[model samples]
Every structure is written in C-alpha cells, then in structure tokens.
Target: MPTILTVPGYQNSGPGHWQSLWEASLGGVKRVEMSSWEHPVKAAWVEALDEAIADCQEPPILVGHSLGCLAIVHWAEGHDREIRGALLAAPSDVERPDALAVLRPFGPIPRLRLAFPAIVAASSDDPFLSPARARILAADWGARFVDLGPCGHLNQASGHGPWPRGEALLSDLR
Candidate 1:
C-alpha cells in the first residue's frame, strides 16, 4: 500500500481539523512538515515536499489543503516522480489580497496539467477562492472537482471535523 502524505495549509491544521483527525485514524498517513508554517517561502515548501516524496518507499497519495495544495502543484511543476494520486481540498487563492500578504511567494499558480491522477474538493462559500475559480483550477490541473456547498475553508469552524465524506473522496482517488 502507498503512503498518504498529509499537507496542511497556512498556519497548519489544528487538532480539531479534519487532516489531524485523519492522521490519527489512518494507518499510513504522514505530514509533510514545513520549515515555517507562519511565513511560507515557496522554495522551502516545495523542497520539503520533494524530500518527503523522495523518501517515500513507493509513490504516495498526496492529501493537501489550502496553501498545501498550492505547494503540491508547485512541487509537481518541477518533480516528475510517479505517485498514486492527489486529494486536494479547499485550495486557497494565493493571488488574492488577503492570502497574498502571506502566500505571495506561491503566486503565478501553475496552470499546467498535473502529472498524476487528482481530485479537488472545494467549498462553495470559501472566502479564499470562489467556487467558479476552484472549478477552473480543477480543469487546469486536470482534476475531478467536487463542490462542497457552503463549507467555509472546510476547516474545523466549518463543521468539518472528522469529515467522513472527504475520507470517501480520498478513497475515490485510486
């Protein structure tokens, strides 16, 4: 079985977050730790993801949220290593003013097709990226898009704790 690499967004996923819950329950889930979660430097994050993938014994399933999704896309821009699939949820719009203040380094979102199978789950009312933009991004990345209605960022406050629906979505990746 392939390992599942959990990549959290800016500031990291808290204990009540779904990613954290999934890690606790899932057998082969490991987080791709960033050097600085508060101040994400694109190069550093991309390098960290690269190293994690390089260390994997087999191609891993990448589960990324928010800025983590951008990091995976950025990592895929350069690395061509084979992977099982990617499950991206609530991807943030780094180019937006609010996000740009922190995620400006990850700008120029890669509009290229992903090298592996991918599924993008997006919230309709997410303050970061509009649902339409999320759909466009999914199309650009050649990923299957799932519209999660009115779920704000799909974080804890969005009432997504232990989101079993998302777990099912991850299972669909294969």
Candidate 2:
C-alpha cells in the first residue's frame, strides 16, 4: 500500500477533524507536522513536506486540506520526486484580499501541471475558496476537480467527521 501523508492547514486540524481521525484509524498514514502551523511560512512549510517525501520508503500519496493544499502545489513546482498522487481538499486562496495575512505568503498559486495524477475536491460553500477558482486550480494542475455542493471547508467546523467519501476519493488515486 502507498504511504499516505496527511498535511493539515492553518492552525492545524483538531483531534475531531477528519484528517486527525484518519491518521489514527488508518494504517500507513503519516501526519506531516508543521512547526509554524499558527504562523505558517511558505518556504518552511514546503521544506517540512520535502523532508517527509524524501524520507518515505516508497512514493506516497499526498493528502492536504486548505492551506496545506497550497503548500503541496508549491512543493510540486520545484521538486521532481515521484509520488502516487494528491487529494487536495478545500484549497484556500491565499491571494484573496480577505484572507488571513499570514497566509498571503503562499499566494500566486502555481499554474503549472503536476507530474503525478491528482484530484482537487472542493466545496461550493467553502468560505476559503470559490468553486470557479477550485475548478481553475484543478485545470491548471491537470487534476480532476470534484465539487461536492454546499459543504463548508470540509473540516470539523463544517462537520465532516470520518468523511467516508474522502476515503473513496483517496482510493481512486491509490
């Protein structure tokens, strides 16, 4: 089985969050910890991800949420390491004027195509990103876009506990 690297966003997914829950319940899943989760630095976040990928014994599938999704995009721009795929859920648009100031560093999302197959799962009602932008992102990255209607952010606050559907999506990339 391919290793699954879970990358959390912003303040980090809580214990009740799907990402955290999946980590505990699933096998061969690693949480890529960020030292600056509260005050994320784009370069640092990418570096931590790089280390995790580099250390993996086999090519791992990346699973990211919100700003973590952006970090994965940024990391893909400069790295050529092989990976199974990516499942980017609710990718935050750091370029938005109302976005958190700390997240602006990850702005200007890369438009280049990714080397691996991937999927961008987004919500229609997510406050962090619009459906149009999410579609555009998936297109730019050459990944399939999945719009799940009005689910907010796909996080704990949006009440996505366990998120069995997400496992199905990940299974496709696997």
| Best-performing candidate as measured by TM-score | 2
Model 2 Cα RMSD, Å? Answer: 0.6
Record all residue pairs in model 1 with backbone atoms less than 3 Å apart, i.e. clashing: none
* TM-score, prediction 1: 0.97
The most accurate candidate by lDDT is: 2
RMSD of each: 0.9, 0.6
Give per-model TM-scores. 0.97, 0.98
State the weakest 10-residue window (summed lDDT) of model 2. 156-165
Candidate 1 lDDT tens digits, 135-163: 99999999999998988999987888889
> Scored by CA lDDT, what does every candidate get?
0.92, 0.94
Q: lDDT tens string, model 2, 56-158? A: 9999999999999999999999999999999999999998889988899898889999999999999999999999999999999999999889999999889
Superposed model 2: Cα runs more than 4 Å off:
none
